[model samples]
Target chain A: MKDTTAHIVEVCPRDGLQNERRVVATEDKIALIHRLIAAGARRIEATGFVHPGRVPQMADAEAVLAGIGPHPGVALIGLVLNRRGVERAVATGALDEVNYVVPLTDSFGKANQGQTTAESLAALPVVRSMAADAGLRTTVTVAVAYGCPYEGDVPVARLREAVRAIADTGPDEVAVADTIGCAVPADVTSRLRAVREVCALPLRTHFHQTRLTALGNVHAAMLEGVTVHDASAGGIGGCPFAPGAGGNAATEDLAWLLHRGGHTTGVDVDAVTRAGRWICDVLGVPPRSAMAHAGPFPTSHPPRGPG
Target chain B: MKDTTAHIVEVCPRDGLQNERRVVATEDKIALIHRLIAAGARRIEATGFVHPGRVPQMADAEAVLAGIGPHPGVALIGLVLNRRGVERAVATGALDEVNYVVPLTDSFGKANQGQTTAESLAALPVVRSMAADAGLRTTVTVAVAYGCPYEGDVPVARLREAVRAIADTGPDEVAVADTIGCAVPADVTSRLRAVREVCALPLRTHFHQTRLTALGNVHAAMLEGVTVHDASAGGIGGCPFAPGAGGNAATEDLAWLLHRGGHTTGVDVDAVTRAGRWICDVLGVPPRSAMAHAGPFPTSHPPRGPG
Candidate 1:
């Protein structure tokens, strides 16, 4: 038997490409989603339904979803910001899950969704009911769960209250997101522990690699019994609202870390790397994943025979 | 009271620069070492005394040492490969410590030092005694302690025997090194445990980030009660003999991880980044450290005011 297993959500096609400067072709996005599934990614955030003017890169969401072939045992998720976005995701008829964001701070909520935090909280149950009626599993992510760009050092009380509010909405899983990559491992440990105290739902962690602490924080979260994580291929993805924030934790790097730490992800490292390199080639950007540049481990070199 | 503390040896000036294609000016090398000291690096590997023809990048060892201004608490170390190299280090009178490598495989030994593993082991005590008589501290690193290029997956018993041999010389510390960055956290845990059983010397870990497991391995070492770690500024340095190996663990990244985990390493993150960026500028390469690219955490941004 494998040591222990965890669920990893490859967010490359949706979260990763949403923030990129170049708009990838619809065919390329579908290809990436397929590759991610082939690499043992059972769940993927395939696309986001936002305004084209807002995120032109994700404007081809419907066409991309149409091109993606359903794979057995894989959940293709589409991100929705409001009721209209939820309708768009449901209309696609391709997504198995619809993910929504619950911005913890009012400033972030107004900036991102043009609604107040209280309003968004009130709307959570409605969105969940709609998605549930559509026969789609729903996930709600608490953005800036650790600290906020608009409000530095979000108090534990505020985060607990937010988790408690989201918990009442009855989402399948609530993601504690570091939207700006500002969290350290200790912060992750304490914050996730706090979330666990108030939340009965399965926990998911979304970390950004802006400060190079994403992997370290992932290790901490694993220690805290967080089995679900969000990562991107080639380390792509950043919050358009969070200034100077870098990419999500690279999928290949996270998979390698998890495997090395005696946890089973069932993700193929080589397949993930190949997908990462391919996407980088598409975007004309360097592959940000360290494993991509460093090549495979136990590099095949013939040992010098008996000397 | 502070949390746990770990000692990190900045090896940029020696191990990092030794592999650079461009030879840094002696003044620049001295400046970089000074910057490291200012960043709370109490122990630094300042230079390597190898044949100038073999490693032209380190040809200015004497000039570089002469240019360094002493910091009160710093221990400047010089790396030497042979007895003659030891003499050269002692003659410089700048290094507080002389570090030697005891290769565990004959293939690596012959390729690196032009000597067999047995010959290097026999010469270890002689070099230590010479450094001891010269009133300099000594450290012997068991290179390829985890895995080797010429011989893949070095047996733990071979490592135990090598450590036992080095232990007999009574060196201050023995670094269990992953010369090719091939180690996983389990490998580090088991191998370090094996080395501890055979050698009572304080253990140090030298890891290359070629496979992106260095920080994870560092966390494992800390759990095993091994506190000393070797890192480089901007993640520079790769073993010339170890093909496909990347740079050493980036010093800034290690310091950030340690600090975030509530461990103290007196090194200032900004100062280390400054040194890292400066060296990268000199080398005409992009800074390899992720933190360097991400900039400092708690990034200052004005909050969107209440509407």
Candidate 2:
């Protein structure tokens, strides 16, 4: 039987593109989202409804959201950091899910949102209530869940305390973001174990390739039973703190790692690699995904279907 | 009982310095070896006894070999490619082990050694016999065992056939080299399994970080009963295929992966990461190993010990 066990969310269109210096014309962002969904992503984080003054790249997020075709089984997600972003995202009526991000480290939260971690936590309840009132699936993504950049490392106690505070918001899922990519496999497994103790909800993992252990960290998380993963086409994504730090684990590379580990990622490796190589030309940087230029497994050399 | 299981062979002195265009001083190579042995590497690939005219990088290999300080238990290994290389290596009286490399793919062998795969294979038995007669431990390292840059995906049939041919030579062990970073976890497990069926000797797997699957591949190999791993200090080695293609798997990263997997790697992750960062600066490149920047586990601004 074809497995339908997990969901892979391709976040390149939104998270990946938001950091670029060159504007990717709203048309390209729209094109990227549609392509990711067609390529087997059940969920795509389409855009963030942040203030244009803060993220001008996402100013036209509504247009990108408008461009998506009505995919019957797929979900469109939009990110929001505060109540205003949520209200704006709710106005679009395009997002099935709205993710609320609250970084765990005070230094990171202050830099990212100009507030302390406690202040972000205080806002989560109202934001979660608003999304729930709008019948939206609420997910709270804790930035630097495994560790942090400015703060060095976020302790399990610090993360668990944030999880407890956010748990009061009644979100459906909690995603641990390795914003600075400082996590090793041990860090991933230990933090996931600690969080699983307090929160009984589904867990998701997001990793960056800064230290090359992103995929391995994902594997360690999956071994502990994580059901959803966050990735970008061509591994394109960035942190506001570490500019030009390669892409979020490429959707194709993540798919390859999962499939090789005997899990069904359901994303085509060749098609994704080709798309990554194509987008590198668009972005003018080599992909952070290792498998992109390394070529596909020869046996997996995508049969052209007898044409 | 404390685990006595993890074994890693440091190859920086040989693999790290082999392809460099700028000639590093002989004293530096010797100092590097002194540090690695002091840091607990039981085996080290010290130098290559190749023709000086062809690989200018190794012109002082003999002199470097002569300057080595004593390590009571450390086994010094030298890389060899043919009967002549083996003859020259055994003459050193410095090598406790000689790794006879046979390029698995014909294209790479020709590019690397100006010989066809068949010629390299035909030469293995003679070298193995000579090493056996001289009472030196001979390790048959099949270069590009996982994938070849010149020749795309190398078949398991090719690797197994090569192993069987070399096994007949009665060498002490066999190692599979990921010449390019083309190997993945599934390949490591599946291909190593096929070889396990044909040969019962210990298996040593070496990998490159070219594609970021290096550590993942190593974890899979260890799961399949591989006891020995080959890694370079500071993740400082690479192939001349091109810059950014990737170098050898960084020593610290591999140790971290294995240690976190509940297996022993017997190397210090902090020391190795520091070495990786230092050596990267020495070579003027970002570390080839991922964990160099990603510090140790549970590593958040913990109390620095009197630093």
DockQ of each: 0.44, 0.24
lDDT tens digits by residue: candidate 1, A222-266: 878898999998898897877677898999888887886688898
Task: Tell me each candidate's TM-score.
Answer: 0.92, 0.82
Candidate 2's DockQ: 0.24
Clashes of 1: 0
lDDT of 2 by residue, B1-307 (tens): 1233668889888887676677778887787788777667789999987777777777787778888966788899998877878888888778789998788877777666666778987887788778877878999788888776655667899889988888877789999888766676767778899998788888898888766777767766665778688999778776553223467888877777667556676677777676666655655677666565545544545322211
Query: Model 2 over residues A191-291: C-alpha lDDT tens digits?
Result: 88889878888888888876677776776666678868998888877865543244588888788767755678778777777766666668787776766
Per-residue alpha-carbon lDDT of candidate 1 for residues B264-292, written as tens digits (9 for 90 to 100):
98889888988998998999888878678
Give the TM-score of chain A in candidate 2.
Answer: 0.93
Error of 2 at A181 (Å): 1.1
Docking class of 1: acceptable
